[model samples]
Target: MIVFMGTPEFSVPILKMLIEEKYNVGLVVTQPDRLVGRKKILTPSLVKQVALENNIEVFQPENLRRNYQYIIDLKPSLIITASYGQILPKELLEKIPAVNIHGSLLPKYRGGAPIQYALFNGDDKTGITLMEMVYKMDAGDMIEKSEIEIDSNDDYGSLSEKLSIVGSNLLKKRLPDILSNNYTKTPQNEEEVTFAFTLKYSDEALDFNQTSKWNHQRIKGLSPNIGAHLIIDNVVVKVFKSQLSDIIDIKPHEIKIENKRLFIGCSDKAIEILELQQAGKKRLSTKDYLNGQNLFINGGMTNE
Candidate 1:
């Protein structure tokens, strides 16, 4: 039997594909539900919600490293993981064959946040990698891979959705060889490896001193979730969307408001803030926000 391990919306389609293909998925393992939003409502991960809907057994272990004996006892023939959030224990991996549907091409962007990094770097393309899972983080023998181009406007949310669907399809196409133990494993080249570690709190802060394209990429990489923010007047203003602008006269970190539009200066040029949210305020379009408030009259923001 196959035990599917994943969390988040990115993993939902992969889990559903296994079910649709009639694979013997014995249990679904996901991250625990946690409090979310200002009201602190407890919420299940998207993968867990899908598993429940499909009548599959679900498991949420707080610390999989210490409490993985239950999974071993099941003796699942294989463990398939995708964005499961936790590294599998060596003891568990030694006992069962496991594979992962990683979001990027193997030996590159090998970590917890590949999808975000792809956008952050302004990559022209990124793809899915289906590979064997070992003790190391994403350093496994590749089984199959599929490439997808990254559109100029694709943000974290849109790119993530594309990768997830591609991942599900890739896994479906290779399951026959995987289950039958008929696949060839190609080792990854150590020289080509790069890591895309998880984003930290500091990573969310935008630096306008960087080039306009650089700051624009940062906004795209974090959008629809952990937004890129600027500290203006000692208040945090989150920027969810932006576009490159022609204004070049404004000094770096300076703000320019003209014709109902908001622009922030960067090293090379300026980036027009398309969507933004002030502290304790709902997100609004630049046009809408300008219609009501005169908060950004004449001041330069600091990197700090």
Candidate 2:
């Protein structure tokens, strides 16, 4: 029997795929419901929803280190984890052969936020790695890996969705060999290792002093979720989509409107804002934003 542990939308695809393939999934472990938004409404994780719909036994543990005995009771032949938020204790790792479906190539971006880091660094390619779970974070030996190209237009949201599907398919393809204990294991090289740590709230603030290309990467890397923010007229604006412009004459953080389009000056060039959301307001295009209210072209944006 397989015991699956995962949380978030990224993990849902793998869990669903296993169920569809008629794998013997004994139990699913996911993070507890979260209080979301200003309303404080409780929301179930995607993995939990999928588990309930499929009639699988589900466990939501506040602390996996303390509550893992429940998983042991299930007698899982193999434990599979995909984007599971918490780290399993060393005791649990020693008991069973746990495998993790990670979002990036091993030894690179091996942490909680691989997708965001891959886009932020402007990588040409990133892929999924199936590895044996160790006690120390994602520093596990790779069992199998599948490559996927990171397209020029791919943002965090789109790339994450694509990677999730890739990871699920890779796991499905390698499961039989893994269960039969026939797969080869490769130790990740220590020298090439790079970490993708969790993003802080300050990471959302865009610095126009950087080159336009760098600023543009920051905008799309955190798009539609933790948006890249900038101060315009003392009001914070979250930038969702932007492109580098040829204009470079203006000072950094200078806002200009041309033909009802919004552009902001950076160090090397200007950035044409395609989509943005002002504080407490809905997201709007440059044209729609201009139609509703006037902007101060003379005022420079504050970085802080």
Candidate topping lDDT:
1
What do the candidate models score in CA lDDT, each in turn? Answer: 0.92, 0.89
Q: What residue pairs clash in candidate 2, if any at all?
A: none
Q: 111-178 in candidate 2: lDDT tens per residue?
A: 89998888888999999999999999899999989999999999988988898999999999999999
Give candidate 2 regions above 4 Å deviation: 294-300
Error of 2 at 117 (Å): 1.2
Model 1: weakest 10-residue lDDT segment is 295-304
Q: Which clashing pairs does model 1 show?
A: none
Instruction: State how far residue 10 of model 1 sits from its true place (Å).
Output: 0.6
Instruction: Please give, for residues 1-304, the per-residue lDDT of candidate 1 as tens digits.
Output: 9999999889999998999988999899999998987678999999999999989999999999998999999999999999999999999999999999999997999999999889989999999999999999999999988999999989999999999999999999898999899989899999999999988888888998899999999999999987999987787889999999998898888888888989888999999999999888889999999887777875447576
**TM-scores, all models, native as reference:** 0.97, 0.94
